[model samples]
Target chain A: MDSIIEVSGITKVYQKRKTKEKIQAVDNISFQVKRGEIIGLLGPNGAGKTTTIKMICGLLKPDSGQILINGVDNEKHRLRALTHISAVLEGSRNLYWRLTVRENLEYFAGNRGVSRKNVASRVEDLLQKFRLKDKETELVNRLSRGMQQKLAIAVAMLADTEVILLDEPTLGLDIETGYEVREILKAIAKEENRTVIISSHDMDVIQDICERTIIINQGKVVTDDRIEDLLKLFEVRSYTITLGEHLNEKQEHLIKERFLDYQYESNRIQPKLSVELLKTEDIYQLFDILKLNETPVEAIDREIIQFEQVFMKIVKGETTNGVDQVKSQSV
Target chain B: MEWIKSNLNLFKANFRKETIELRRYLPNTIAMLLTVYIIFMAMFAGIHSVGAPGTVDATIQNTIVNYIFWYLTITIVNGQGYEILTEATRGTFEQLGMSPSGIWRILSARLLAQGILTAAMMIVLLYLSMLTTGQSLNVDFVTIIPIFLLTCISMFGLSFIIAGLTVIVKQIQAFLQIFQFVLAALTFVSLSRAPFLVFFPITKGVDMIRAVMVEGLTLNELGFSNFLVLTTNALVYFIIGLATYLYCERYAMKKGLLAHY
Candidate 1:
């Protein structure tokens, strides 16, 4: 796919007003967004997501690096480069609170160089698409958070720009509204074939909507890969085995050495061993431990690991390979 | 032609938005009118009680022009500054930056719309102040137009400087207040008595405006030399103000202050 947005070695540093200490907000980060790709920009709080977004949107100048939008350098030709992109920033910052929904749309459309005659029809179309037709006359402040977010996105879409940048699109929204927004974004990305770069704390948003994700930590990209590959790589399957009798000391020691997170329950009526295996083949090692005590395996059940857990594990610096030493010791 | 059309459309759109906001916030407009009225009434009462009814009318007219001059200066300075401050606070600065219109076009459109509104409001208040004082001052807008345009150009320059400063300096209100007082003193200074003060922004232009209103000096009657001096003040300050504003904008963007309130 042709790249619509190319961000190369972009860095930004901010100075604390009082202490005069320089803080690197974005440290030599680089990524290319292909056309029509919905890529999730994931990070923890204060992880330079907003700073990166601002640089790409031309709101802030990068300390060093180049950002090209549709082959135009944003820093050199801001107005020309920015014409190809539209951003829906976090919160109500992008919206005019005092203006009605329809007014805001028309105003931004005009501001974005949309023709005078087409603004009305374009706003009408977005109003219907975002389900904001009923509240078109309502003031932006009067709309709920979810509706405001929808309107913000709708306003960005009004420009009909090729690339849309959204910072925390589903932040502070209810589950149902969040779900609705996710579906709306998915439909837009697929049907419109518009490139989208979304920064969100919600893992579900990344897992469900984005095909690929760039995870940042401490102002740096820690992992940039496909969501499916990440899930498969960090697939930690947990299994519980019911034993006829309690395990001896050697077996207990062996179980502790093999698994990173597991529970050995001996006092209950059914002695069960819950083991988290990083690799599927580790189940053989687990059965070996249980067989040492001649304990019969009555039943076994596996626990499902979710994308949220995978995200947590990755962010906490516990990559799937981090436990290979335990696996080596068992051998 | 296409570029000009797009910029004009942006200007018209911004004007419409400002008008809608003015209509929606009726109390703010009313309060602004009352504030001007009260200030004008105090000036009228002070001069009337001095027992100079003959000079009272002329004095009131002169004061009205001066008041309008001061109002335009302060409004342009603070209004443009606050527009940026408010956008930053509301987080719309990024959105504005992302638009194809650019900051220069956006600010120009907004400031032009605001200047027209302020000029209209000043005219209405001038009439109301005259009626309330039971005195009529010969006011000629045709004569005022040339002087008004020159003065407003200089004032717009000052406004650009203030807007730029507001971007770099987070707490600029205190500085703006102090600068307002300095501007008042310079603008009210007698150019004939202390001729050197005419170089300051809006100083000579306000004096010329007073001459047009109180003395009924036509643009031709004001003489080319005096007109030239006012023109120089307007052009020089305008260029200086624009340069300062552009410099401040570059620094602010480098420091990432555009996103900060």
Candidate 2:
């Protein structure tokens, strides 16, 4: 894959007005975006996702390091580099509130030097694709949040840039609109063959659309991996065991001692134990504890974990050394 | 050539947008029209009060000329420059800055649009004054046209200065109000005492216009020295405004205030 954007050792620090304390918004970070890749930038609030995206889009300059768009240094040849990228920042900042949707599209297209004759057809195609044809004549401010967001993306698309930077595209949309946006993004990534870097708190949107994910915490990247790999790695270790009989006090004590994070639910007729194992062999040790009480296990099933749970584990620093421990115990 | 093509498109689009915005604020337009009418009516009343019975034509011509100068200056300052300030306050300045077009071209186009509107207003007001006061229609088109053009160029320069101030101050409307107050006082000083204000550019322009319209002085009769001073002042103000805009652009970038609303 060809790298379309190369961001290396980028850092941004903002000075607090009252305290005059410097806050690091983006720490020394380096990442490369391949052509036609959909990458998700995930982080909690104040984790510098926005600052990082702004730096990449040339909206905000980094304190140190270089951002190369198509091998052109953004700071050195800003207009030239920016010509190949467009951004739909948070809260739909790219739009004109009073201009009608059609007018905004035409204006942006014209700004990009698209011929007057081509603007109409290009706008029509985008309006139809974004499902905003009916609202073409409506003022942007009058449109619903979902429509505004769609129009913003549509406008970015009209710029015909190779890379599209979307900051919280689904930040304030309803579930249906969010899903629609996700579908549109998927289509855009697949059909248009454009690089997309999305900074968002919506894990579902990230899970549904992005192939790779970069998780940031405290302005530093904690994990950058394929989404499926992270999900499978975290999912394989969780299990729920159905016990044939209730656990006695001694057996419960031993189980608690061995499996620190296990849960016992006594409400079910058979009773159930939910635990995550560092290794598949750890289940045998669990069996050893049940055997001490002569308690038989009826069945054991793997627990499917969502991306949100895997994210929580990674963010809490619980998964850093667990992968090694799991491998040793399983072998 | 490329710049012209791009600016032509930008100017057309911006002019259309401004027209839409102006139409939406119909009440303001109506208010402006009423204000212009009232000023003319008040001038007529004042002329009648001064025991000038048969000198209505001369008085009306004098009042119309003054009104043209005053109204055009006020409109350019408050109308076009105020809109630029509003755009700055709304964070649209960053949007414009990020565009490939230069700031000078964008602003110049806006001023050109304002000049056209001001010229149209002056013509309408001239006609209206003629109908109301029955002024002699013996107007010297050759003299009035050049005076009007020079006045507009000077006003454009002043508007640019005001726009630069608006960007630096951030609070556009308040800055404009204060600017207008100072301008009103300065105009009073210049008009009340001619010799004391002859050193000022605006006053000099007004004097030249009054000389030709009221005293019927030709370009040769007035000599080239006064024209040279007026032209120099306009050029100086325009250069100052451009320099101020460039300085403000740098300040905004360093302070990270371009995108701040």
Candidate 3:
């Protein structure tokens, strides 16, 4: 697929206002988002996801490197480059509070370069498509958060830009509303060929919608892979072992030292052991620890890993193999 | 032609938006207009109570010009900065920046819309003050147009400086308030009395307008050389203000201050 957005070695550093200490917000990050692809940007708070998204949308300039949209360098030709892009930045509801839904749509459509004659029809189309037709005459501030978010996205779409960047689209939304928004994004992705980059903390959003996911932690890209591949890789190592007896001190110490995120439940009558190994062959190491005390292993079953668990592992820096798997897949 | 066409579209969109906002906040607009009216009446009453009857007409005439000039200066100066601050506060600054019209075009359109509305309001107030004070004066657009145009351009230039500085120095209202007092003082400086003060961007134009309004002086009567001096001050200040704004904007983007309120 041809790349629609290329972010090359972008780095952003900020100095603390009081102490004047330099903080690396994004460190030499590079990625290419292909045309019509829905890429999820996953990261914990303060992980530089917002910084990266801002740079891509031309809201912030990187100290080093470039962002190109369809071969136009954003830094060199900002307005021209941004012509191909639209973004709903985190915390930027991006609607005039005083403007009604229809007015907001019309204003943004005109402001984003739609001709005066086309603005009304385009806004009407979006209003109907986004299911905001009922609330078209309502002020944006008066709408529910879900409706506001849908309007923000609808306003972004009014530009008809090739790439749309949504930062935390589902943040601060209720379960039903979040699901509705997720459905809206899903529909947008399926219905349009535009490239969509969503930066979200919700694992379900990444799992259900994105074709590819870029996980960032501490100003670095920790894992970049398809959500399926990550889930597959992490699921194989997760094992729940029914131990014949409670783990002895040496066995517990050995397991703790080997597995960083293992849970050993001493349930007295029926002790349980759960561990996620780095490798499939590493089961021998677990057997060795159990064999030391002649501890019987009643049954060992592979635990099903969710996208959230896989994400936690990657962000917690518990799995280098996950990054390696993703790196190899990208190649 | 394409550049003109695109900018015109932007201006139209922004003008419409502001108009909608003005209508939406109609009560606020009326309140602001009422406040201006009350202040004008208070100043008139105060002047009438304290001043000599013989000089009352002259004082009233001079006061109208001075108050208009001061009001225009502060509104343009404070208003330009306030627009930027409000955008930042609302978290809409980035969206405005990201628009294909660009920040400069957007700000230009917004300011132009505001300028039109303000000019109309000022004209209304000018007539109201004259009628209420029981004074009749010559209302010549020919004399007022040139001076108004010159002052607007000069003040716009100064406003650009204020707006640019606002991007870096978020707490700029205090600075603007101080500048308002300085402008209040500058509005009284007569070009005929102190010709060297023509070096000031707005004083020359204010003095020229006061001359035209009070003394009924024509462009030729004011002398073409004096007109040149007035235009020169406006042009010079506008160029400096534009340069300062462009520099500050570039600096703000580099420092990531564009996202800061």
Candidate 4:
């Protein structure tokens, strides 16, 4: 697939007002969104997701490096390149609060120089698609937050841009509304043949809607891969072992020595062990420790690590050894 | 042609929004009209009580003109730019920035809406003054119309400057308050009968308009020298305003300050 949006080596630095210290908001990040792909940009708070999104949509000029949209340099011909992109930054902040939903849609369409005849049809289509027809005449400020958010995305869609950038689309939303927004985004990505770059902290939204994710931490990209691959990679090494009896002091020390990280709960008679293996043979090492004590294993199940936990581990820098392990396994 | 098309659409959309918003503040508009009427009535009554001096009519007319100018300036500076600055603070500037239209078009549409609303208010005040005072009509239409248009453009230019400053400066509400005081002082000092003040641009515009409206000076009578100075002042102020706005735009882009409120 052709790359619809290519961000290369972008860096954004912000100067503190009082002390004048330079803060790196986005540091040397590069990523690509293929045509018709829904890519999630996931990170903790203050992770430069917003800065990267702003740079791509031409809201902020990066300190260095280039962004190309549809093979056109975004900085050189910003207007032309922006013609292929639309953004819903911070959700309802992009909307005209005083204007009605339909009016806002019409206004943005008219600004894009769409014909009057086509504007009505386009606005109607968006209203229907976003399920906002009942609130078409209501002022944006009067609508519920979820309705306002839906209208915002619908307005971006009205521009018919090839790429849509959504910054925290489901932030601060109720669970039901968040799920509704995720479903709407999923539908847009699947049915519209449009490329989407979503910056969000909602792990479920990313896992369900996005095929690939670019995870950032402290202004740098830690991992960028397909969602399936990340899940599978983290899953294989994770296991939860249920023991038949508590381990002795020596056995506990040995288990702790064998595993890179483990959690121990002493209250339970049958101790449970959650372990992440670095090597395939490490499982035998765990078994050997249990065998020495004649410990009965009630059950040992391979744990499926959720994307949220993987995200936490990646941000905490546990993935460096994991990457090394993967390299050795491939060799 | 494309610029015109885009600007016209922006103007229409923005004007609609402004109209809707202003509708909610109808009480303020009503109060303003009443105040204009009462102030003109009081001025007319005072002039009548002063035995209808030869300069009384001119003085009253000048006062009314000053009032209208300051009223419009305060509204534009305080109300219109306040809305724009609030939007900027809320990150709505990014929405406007991402649109196909240029910043100049957005600014122009806003100014156009302000101009129309100001003109409407001025006309209503003029009619109310005429009805109450029955002031003699001596204004030269040819010169007065052009002068009025220039004054409107000059005020619009100032409004743009204020909007641009609001983008760069953090505390715009305080700045706007200071601007209101400065504008009041400028209007008062320039329109007053002070010989040394004639060199100021505000004084020049006011004196020229007063001469045409009160003294019944025709274009030929005013001479090319007077027209040259008035137009030059208006043009220079307009150029300075545009230059300031361009500088602000570059600064905003460089500093990422466009959405900084």
Candidate 5:
């Protein structure tokens, strides 16, 4: 697929007002979001995710690098580039609190130079689709936070731009509302061939909706690949071993010493040792420890990993030394 | 035609927004209108109670014109700054910044809408003050509108300056409060008192309107030279204000201050 958004070597630095100390928010970050692709941008707090998103939205200028939206250079022609993009930047705050749901939608469309009459039907569709038709006449301030968020997304959707950037879309939503919002985003991506870039802390949302995930940590891209690929790579390294006999204290200590991330569950009906081995050959060392105890191995199975664990490892910079390095060696 | 239609759409959207807000904040709008009216009446009473009967009517007429222009200048000019501050606090400034119609155009449409409404309010105040002082000043919008519109251009220009500054500083309340007096000085001081004041923003337009309203001058009677100065002042101030605003906006974005709140 052709790329719709190209960000090349972007960096943002900020100076503390009082201390005058410079902080690097985004350091030489580069990525391409292909058309119709849902890419998740993940990072911990103060990791420059918002800064990078704002720069991509043309709301902030990077110290270096260029952003092209649909081949239009954002910095050189920010407004024109804006024509191809919209964002749900601040969630509920992206809307006019005093305006009704419908008014907010119409007003935003009008700002894009689309006449009110022209967008009336699309507004109705969004209202119905977002489950906000009943609240169309209600003031945004009076509505629930979830409804306000849905309205904010609806307003961005009303722009009908090629790319939609959502920063923490489900940040403060309740469980049901978050699920509803997730469903809405999924529906939008499935129906429209629009490129969606979502920055979220919800790993489930990322795993469920995004084909690719870009994990950023300390103003750098730690990992950029498909979610499934990362899962598969991590899964292959994790093993759950069932033993026919319980291990002695020495064997348990040695096993723990060998695999620092090992889990021993002798309290269960069956004795088991679960561990993730960075090197697949490390399993031989694990079996050697079992041999010393003369413990028979009942069954061995690969442990399935969760996206949240993958996100944690990637953000902690452990993936580079562990799974990512292993993948490079395999390649 | 495409340009016209696109711009008209922007204008209509913004105009409708302002109208809806006015309706929503009806009590606030009415209170502000009443405050201005009461203040004008108090000034009229002060002139009435004081001596100097010979020039009382003349001063009253001048005050009416000056107050109208001052009201228009302050509300529309300072309004831009207040609007930005509110938008920033509300977290909607970035959305407005992303508008393809351009933030400048949206603000221009907003100010124009406010100016029209203020003009309507000014007429009521003009007639009300005339009734209070029993000094029947001319109510000729035919002559006053051209002058009012020209003066509004300069006011809008100053508004742009404030809007730009607000984007950067984000706390322009103190500056805007001080600017109220600056605007007052510009609107109240006549060019005859200081001929150089003719070049100042809003001053020339206010003086010309006062001439037409108090001195019974018609559009043709005001002469083309008069228009040349007014139009030149409007355009010059407008260009300078817009340029300053655009520069500040780019600086704000570069510094990542677009939506700090």
Candidate 6:
């Protein structure tokens, strides 16, 4: 697929107010978002996710490199780039509390240089689609948080831009509203066929709406691949082996050398060895270690991994020597 | 033609939004207008209590012109700056910055809308003040409109400067509070007494407005050099103010200030 947004080697640095110490918020990060593809940008706190989002939105200028929206360089042509993109940076806070729902739509559409008369039909369609038709004339602050959030997203959609960047679209939302937001996002992607880059800590939203996930850690892109591939990779690489007897010293040493990251449960009734292999065939090496002391393997279970766990493990730097070494998506 | 259409739409959008907000926040709107009236009344009361009874009528009329321009100046400049502060606090300012028409254009449109609304209120206040003082100077809007509009251009320029600072610092309330008095000084101080004030934003326009409203001067009577000064102040200050605003915007973006308070 052709890329709709190209962020190339972008870096952002900040200075501490008193000491003037330089902190690199984003360190040489780069990613390409395909047209009509929904991608998740996941990271921990202070992990440069907001910095990258602001850069993409043209609200913040990166110290180095370039961001191109529809082949237009954002830094050099920020306004023109904005013509092709819009964002809901703070969800409900993005709206005018004093303005009504319909007024907010018209106002934001106007901001994008589209007249209210021109977008009147589109606004009605969005209000109906987002289930906000009944509350069109209600003040934004009077609306429920879910409705406010939906209006914010509706405002973004009204811009009619190709790419929409939503930072924490579901933040501070209740479960049902969060679910509703997720559904709206899914519908937006499917119906509009627009490229969407979402930054969220909610793993479920990412897993449900995004085909690809980019995990950032310590100001670098650690893992960028398919969400399903990551789930399957993490699932297949993990194995739990139950031994009939405790492992001898040689077997323990061999297991530790072969699998740097594993759980040894000798204290339990059955000595179980939980290890993740770099490759599926590495299970043979584990078998060799088990045979050294005639350690009888009673059962071998492959541990199933959830996307949240996959995200956690990737972000915690746990995948560095294991999966990261083999795949090496990090820069 | 497309540029004209989009910008017109942009202006209409903000203009309607501002008008709707004014209507929705009717109590606050009334309070703002009343506050100016109350202040003018107090000034009128002062003129009555201690005065040369012979010059009382002229003094009241002059005070009315000064107070009217002060109202326009304060609301035109500080209103937009207050908006910047509020939007920054509420996190909506960045949304304005995200517009394709650009923040500067939106702000310019918003400032114009605000100026028009304030002008309407100022007219009502002028009539009320005249009724209260029972000393009408001149109600000639034909002469006053051109001067008021030109002065508003300079005021818009000053507003852009305030907007630039507010977006970057978000804590310029103290400066704005003190600046209102400075605007008062500009509106109250005459041209012949301080000729150099002509170069400053809004000062020339206000002096010209004072001439038109208080002295009943026509456009031709204002002459070539004075009109030149007025036109130059409007254009020069507007260009300078917009440039300063854009520069501060670039600085804010570099410092990542747009997203935070």
In terms of DockQ, which candidate is strongest?
6
- Candidate 2 regions exceeding 4 Å error are A18-21, A90-94, A112-115, A248-260, A266-268, A291-294, A321-331, B23-28, B43-67, B78-81, B84-94, B102-108, B133-169, B185-212, B215-231
Answer with 3 or 6, whichever has the higher lDDT: 6
Report the error of model 1 at residue A287, Å. 3.7
Tens digits of per-residue lDDT, candidate 5, A14-75, equal 99889999999999988888899999999999998999999998999999999999999999
Best-fitting candidate, measured by TM-score? 5
Residue-wise C-alpha lDDT for candidate 4, range B22-116, written one tens digit per residue: 67568976887888678767867876788458877776776766666677667765654686677786767778778766565667677778777
Instruction: Work out candidate 6's RMSD over C-alphas.
Output: 2.6
Q: CA shift at B43, candidate 5, in angstroms?
A: 0.7
DockQ of 5: 0.83
User: Which docking band does candidate 2 fall into?
Assistant: acceptable
lDDT tens readout by residue for model 1, A246-272: 888999998898787889889988898
Best-to-worst order by DockQ is: 6, 5, 1, 3, 4, 2
lDDT of 5 by residue, B12-32 (tens): 889899899989999998999
TM-score of 2: 0.84
Q: Could you tell me how far off, in angstroms, the CA of residue A282 lies in candidate 6 after the best superposition?
A: 5.9
Q: What is the C-alpha lDDT of each candidate?
A: 0.82, 0.74, 0.83, 0.77, 0.88, 0.87
> Comparing 1 and 6 by DockQ, which wins?
6
Q: Which 10-residue window of candidate 5 chain B scores lowest in summed lDDT?
A: B132-141
Q: Please write out the lDDT profile of model 3 over residues B1-261, one tens digit for every residue.
A: 877777777778888888899899999988998898898789889999999989989888889888877887777777989888887878788888779787766777777888878888888988988888887666789878887888888888888888889988887878877887888877876767777777777998888888888878887788988778878888898889888887887777777898686
Model 5 TM-score, 2 decimals = 0.95
Model 6: residues >4 Å from true position, as ranges? Answer: A241-300, A320-331
DockQ of 3: 0.55
lDDT string, candidate 1, B1-261, tens digits: 988778778887888888999999989989988987788788778877894756777777777777766777788877788778788778887788788788766887888888888889888887887777765665877767887888888888888888888878756767877888876776666688788887787888888777877777787888889878888988988888888887887788889887676
> What's the ranking of the predictions by lDDT, best on top?
5, 6, 3, 1, 4, 2
Q: Each model's TM-score, in the order given?
A: 0.92, 0.84, 0.91, 0.88, 0.95, 0.93
Interface RMSD per candidate = 1.3, 2.9, 1.4, 2.0, 0.8, 0.8
* True-structure RMSD for candidate 4: 3.6
TM-score attained by chain A of model 4:
0.91
